[model samples]
Target: MRADGSGSGTLSRLEIDSLKAGVRIEDLAARYVPSLRRVGERWVGLCPFHDDTRPSFNVWPDSQSWYCFGACRRGGDVVDLLREAEGVDFRRALELLGGPPAGATAGRGWQSPLPVAVPRQSEAEPELTCEDRAILNAASEIYYQSLMTNAAMRRALQARGISLGTAQTYHLGYATGRRLARYLAWRHLDLERARCLGLLHDRLSGEDGANGDTSGDDVWEHLSQRLVVPVMRGWETVYLIGRATREAQRPKYLGLALPKEPLTGRGRPRRSQGIIVVEGPFDLLLLHEWGYWRQFELLALLGTQFKRRWLAHVGPDDRLLVATDQDDAGEAAAAELMAHFPGQAVRLRWPEEYKDVGDLAQAPDGHKIWARALSDA
Candidate 1:
């Protein structure tokens, strides 16, 4: 835990050797580089330590070692890979691999001979005020009620494999564009605050008698005519993201003026195996619909970037099943995330025909396809 990796000395040589023997170097290397493919006896992939253009990273299962023949030009055992990828010291790496050796006491004064570095923390979400909570709660309720009555919207969702039960479970809603302003006024909520939160806009308001009346028709809903996906933390709606329903809509998604957080699923089982990370909210919804949530915690990145802040939800030993889209950007994002958690992440390999989980869900045997993928992981 110290900057100089001083605390690592407590672990005995036997403990370090046990940790090294328990983990396979080639298997650990594959987590950092998902593209690793077998070449005769050795596996090869692009080097994760640097910008690799060719297959210069080599992993030998026979020797339990890896070497990057490209830009990094370095090679070592599993411990070296963990230290390099996680930016931790020998003691920390051993701890991450499998805690202290049996019968080792924490009170021991022994120190690790190897040096260590401080691990980086992700940026924290901005603090939300009381007023912010009130506005978000009201907006979410109004949208939920709106979706209940909109038969067309319900039918649209059904066509996409999202059922009425699933929609209600996730608190999915529809934005009427004209409802929020009036609802906030009826509740005597501050319209200016809502505008500041990216829920309302004043582009249509004219420069007439400037009395600062935002509750009137002058203000417009920011997510009008789009499907609402409220990112909730327990009972509170922390963030709201909207997806365009119509094909003609230019921007596919929109969000409130808040830090982007992964849209998570409800009730993660106490003994869940790992986190199932997907690209879009729909992809997550379909997975839940097919009963994947029973075994794994689900998270939708909402986009390609995976922030370090999200790591708080993951347990130290839990694996990350990266099921992003099969496209170029998704592949790149998965690789980046895998590299961040070497030996603890696996890129879920989807069938080549399907571009993503959402597309795969449309097939008659979509559930089976996903089951097979998870089993392999």
Candidate 2:
């Protein structure tokens, strides 16, 4: 455990403000100081910061704050508790609350105790070209409409407990082997744009010379035989992802190589009080079926690596619920999400019997378990 909180990633003032406003110090303190007893409106327990025979630590759930009237006399919000308990600096504290890695390069790090943005860097992300953006949008829509017409794709959703209506709401679609190239040709869309979206690779002049002329032999449809789901920011499509429809597909999922949008002097992302991040789009579909979206802003990250663009989707005041798959990679993704977020983000662990939320939905008592987790959260 490195306690040198020198500096690393940077968090904005707004993000810090949001974290302080979002995390309740009492719940945080409970992680360090156990055997807490509620008295009046505060939870009193021994201060873990120092040796104490009597309970001198008081955490106010209503105020969403904490303080110690004992020897340590050192008390603050969840960030402070993490700092002292972990013997790390404010930056490390923020990381513990989901800032960045403790050993990341040094800087002012985050000014706010709470972080809701990705670790600040010295440079901004490169902008996507118009053609790149166009292909993403077109391919997404093409796959979605194509999925609606495919019974196998719809059946895949049904097997997962996802309703067709839910799929439609998400604009879920399928990619027929060569439909995109034909559509592009019919619409006179740019072939270069299609190539950029990974829907087409460079056709060799020798091998496929005249083969490209026919739709069946055309190798342009990148996500062929997969269900396409567009990753959107509000109403705008930002990225395109594919889930393999066949069990024999090696990777099971595929994605465009386009870079996700990062925060760019955009003031601040809209606050939704609470945000829930899940692994695949289908997980979101399941939650949507249960109307969970009404309670929290549900975000499906397609696969879990915690894209930089997702930072702009979160507000400093937002509380995050990470409900990723319960596996090694999923756990890694959850850790990454926490590192990037300064706000209060709790990972909702599924029972050992279930692999993920989507898998759990198939269990008879799954909804009951889900409801319990929500109620406890």
Candidate 3:
């Protein structure tokens, strides 16, 4: 609950621990540990932590923990359980499970202390919240995991000339939610937050319509049908863009909206004075995979829908490299963006045959291609 008494919910660590301790591991596991089966009071699931056809994963209801008695033995408390099940970190687990542990801050100052060093909201952009990152990370992880497991994404990558090993190395993932509303509901995410972040539609009827932007639902409605690429700022999954796999789908690509809630800058910085802007996530991943990321940091508009102020945030001293696709759309988008940076923007040109940085990376003369792209700028 917030101090203003407006917020309706809270996240308590004790409550989470109690939920773990009281809830039957079998029942709890059944709810979230996908691909798991319940037997008597114990739950047996395919160990996500290990490779196993046999069910060796066991959960202890009383202990509020799970253990995998397999080659890749792994298990721990409910926190660990959620971490593995959701593929997220501790902070996110805390968010999903609800507030911190009871009495953990019992002795803390009662008086409302000095306001923490909050992020100053940009007048141009509404303040984003810490919860926004939590939702983004969770969604990004789910989409990424889907890509790793989806057969179509792998085939699509191959068709694009990206090798299987390279795809995994880049942590490529896909989104295939048969229904966006159901996915968001399962995660306990508020519909407004999803709508605000451009994850769900506002006019879907029922509870969804109350949220807003019925049109945005069209973006995620085809997720299970698209190739998802996560855009990470440092370790935090801040933004994502989805590309449709089906040839007939209209508006071939979609991006998550810029978060309107206040954003918390807790993790390490993910930008640099030198930014290499790419049109697609695969190209960004390819650059990072090949150690080219360090020479020049990578950033993406996720597409051309970026606000003009987004470019304004880039410091005047920073170097901006436009590495859009070699095709017509890429060239046009690059031309528009180049006009924004003016003196700071440098265009990365390549052979007419190469369509993107990923293509250049895979070329027989990859190093030379990169050199040429860098030099031609």
TM-score on alpha carbons, each prediction: 0.64, 0.59, 0.50
Between prediction 2 and prediction 3, the one with superior lDDT is 2
Please report how far candidate 1 places residue 157 from its true position, in Å.
Answer: 0.8
Instruction: Encode model 3's per-residue lDDT on 81-141: one tens digit a residue.
Output: 7778779776455444433333233223232211122333445545457877777777776
Worst 10 residues of 2 by lDDT: 260-269
Clashing pairs in 1: 8-112, 9-111, 9-112
| Candidate 2 Cα outliers beyond 4 Å, as residue runs | 1-124, 202-216, 260-273, 307-309, 312-317, 339-343
Q: Candidate 1 residues 1-377, lDDT tens each? A: 22121264354333455556667777678778998987544577878999977676767664466777455656777888999988987667776676553335443434433332233364565677999889999999999999999999999999999999999998999998778889999999999888777787553213111112244477667688889999998889888999878765524676766677789887676678898999899999998888878888999999876778787767779899999999855876787778778899899986899989988888999778988998999
Over 4 Å off, model 1: 1-125, 205-216
Query: What are the per-residue Cα lDDT tens digits for candidate 2 across 10-72?
Result: 444434444555455666676778868775345778778777777767665533556665566
> lDDT per prediction?
0.76, 0.64, 0.58
TM-score of 3: 0.50
Candidate closest to the true structure, highest lDDT: 1
**Whole-model lDDT, candidate 3?**
0.58
Q: Ranking under TM-score, best-scoring first?
A: 1, 2, 3
The residue-level lDDT of candidate 1 at 307 comes to 74
